[model samples]
Target: MKKRLLSRLLLTSLSPFLFINTASAAEQAMIVFDASGSMWARVDGREKIVVAKDALKQVVRQWNPETQLGLMAYGHRR
Candidate 1:
């Protein structure tokens, strides 16, 4: 129940970015993801990395294919 609610809230907060004006020129988005050690910590008994991955999946599913998307991950390596 909590996970579903959190997912809905996350998607709602990002709705603006998901729906960009197609009338304008091509849009570009850069997603900066954190893969630090802290992300291994648990939230509500689930790992933060798991939560983040789920959210990213949701965002990508709704993303406009016409728009360019880039990903940059940090803190993955020592």
Candidate 2:
């Protein structure tokens, strides 16, 4: 019981410091999509590009908008 109490006290004291370091940090990510001709090819009667777009949309829906995100697509032109 005594050890548990001390552990809890230590955690309580340190929690503020742990959180302070995170407040100024913004998470960032980059998503690269291939728009190549192959992506336009069909699989199971569904174009690969269509599948990729749907998957990306679903992911963005669940993601926190506060996170910095960048997107790039390749192979749109010759």
Candidate 3:
């Protein structure tokens, strides 16, 4: 019985270290968008900007809640 208890104690003490490599950090995603006037052009009866926004929304909904997302816009005149 003493051997079993000692083995359990050792296992418990080392379990964290043994499994440490399996732990993972949450991943982050950045989504960049073009805000140029060209994006406002109509395509297939829908504006390109609208289509891009809809797609981004869908992707954001599908991503894991723990994951972080950042939005950036470029191409607008300075």
Candidate 4:
């Protein structure tokens, strides 16, 4: 039973990244993105931050403007 529980926990933990292609169906959904130094790195031809914000904005734009949306960024402090 313990082994099964452990496997389930691992599956749940990895499921988020594993199903990145699936869009959320919730009427309201909030996404938390880490905006630490790593996001400043290069991605494709632009910085990761630029890419992330653009991607987020693209998604947010697709949803209803009145739809509940929230964003929080964390950590770049000394």
Candidate 5:
């Protein structure tokens, strides 16, 4: 119940990142991830970090191969 909801919310929030104007000449995208300590907290019996990783994997699998992808993470260090 809660697990599904959490997953759905995460995916929904990230949907915008998946849908971009591919017609643009740049054809690039970047994912800004949260790696703060708070992400270690558990949500629906699973660590939030775990949930985020799973969600990112799904997103990457569906991502357009032609688009150049970049990732930038912050909040990992105290």
Candidate 6:
């Protein structure tokens, strides 16, 4: 039992180091927000466009330097 426990602890501790050398995070991210009037349209008693806009602003402000984003909207024309 002692030997098994030691081996289990050893493997558990070393597993993170093994991944430290082999694993890496991705390099890029992207975010987009729709600006259309329909995006602002209320659905299910909630305003989707308003919610989306606020969420998008928060996320974009917190984005990493390696990220890029594009925004587009439609249907507000006269």
Question: Highest TM-score among the candidates is held by which one?
Answer: 5
Clashes of 1: 0
Q: Please tell me which model should have the higher lDDT, number 1 or number 2.
A: 1
List the candidate 3 regions with Cα displacement exceeding 4 Å.
1-24
Between candidates 1 and 4, which one is better according to TM-score?
A: 1
- Provide C-alpha RMSD values for all models, in order: 3.4, 16.7, 21.2, 11.9, 2.4, 17.3
Across 44-71, the per-residue lDDT of candidate 4 in tens digits comes to: 4567666666555655566676456666
TM-score of each: 0.73, 0.65, 0.62, 0.55, 0.81, 0.41
In order, candidate lDDTs are 0.76, 0.62, 0.60, 0.56, 0.81, 0.47
- On a 0 to 1 TM-score scale, where does candidate 4 land against the true structure? 0.55
Ordered from best to worst TM-score, the candidate numbers read 5, 1, 2, 3, 4, 6
* Per-residue alpha-carbon lDDT of candidate 1 for residues 1-78, written as tens digits (9 for 90 to 100): 988776676567645554444455888776777699998998778887787789889889977897888777899984
Candidate 5 structure lDDT: 0.81
Collision pairs in model 5: none
lDDT of 3: 0.60
- Which model is ahead, 2 or 6, in terms of TM-score? 2
**Local accuracy of candidate 3 as per-residue lDDT tens digits, 1-78:** 643444354445433432222234856656666689998987656676776666556566766776666677888876
What is candidate 4's CA lDDT for residue 77? Answer: 72
The C-alpha stretches of model 4 lying farther than 4 A from their native spots are 1-26, 76-78
Colliding pairs, model 6: 39-49
User: Which candidate ranks first by lDDT, i.e. highest?
Assistant: 5
| Residue pairs with clashing backbones, model 2 | none
Instruction: Residues 1-78, candidate 2: write the lDDT tens digits.
Output: 643444354445433432222344786666676789998887656676776676566556866787776677889984
Off by over 4 Å in 2: 1-24
Residue pair clashes in candidate 4: none
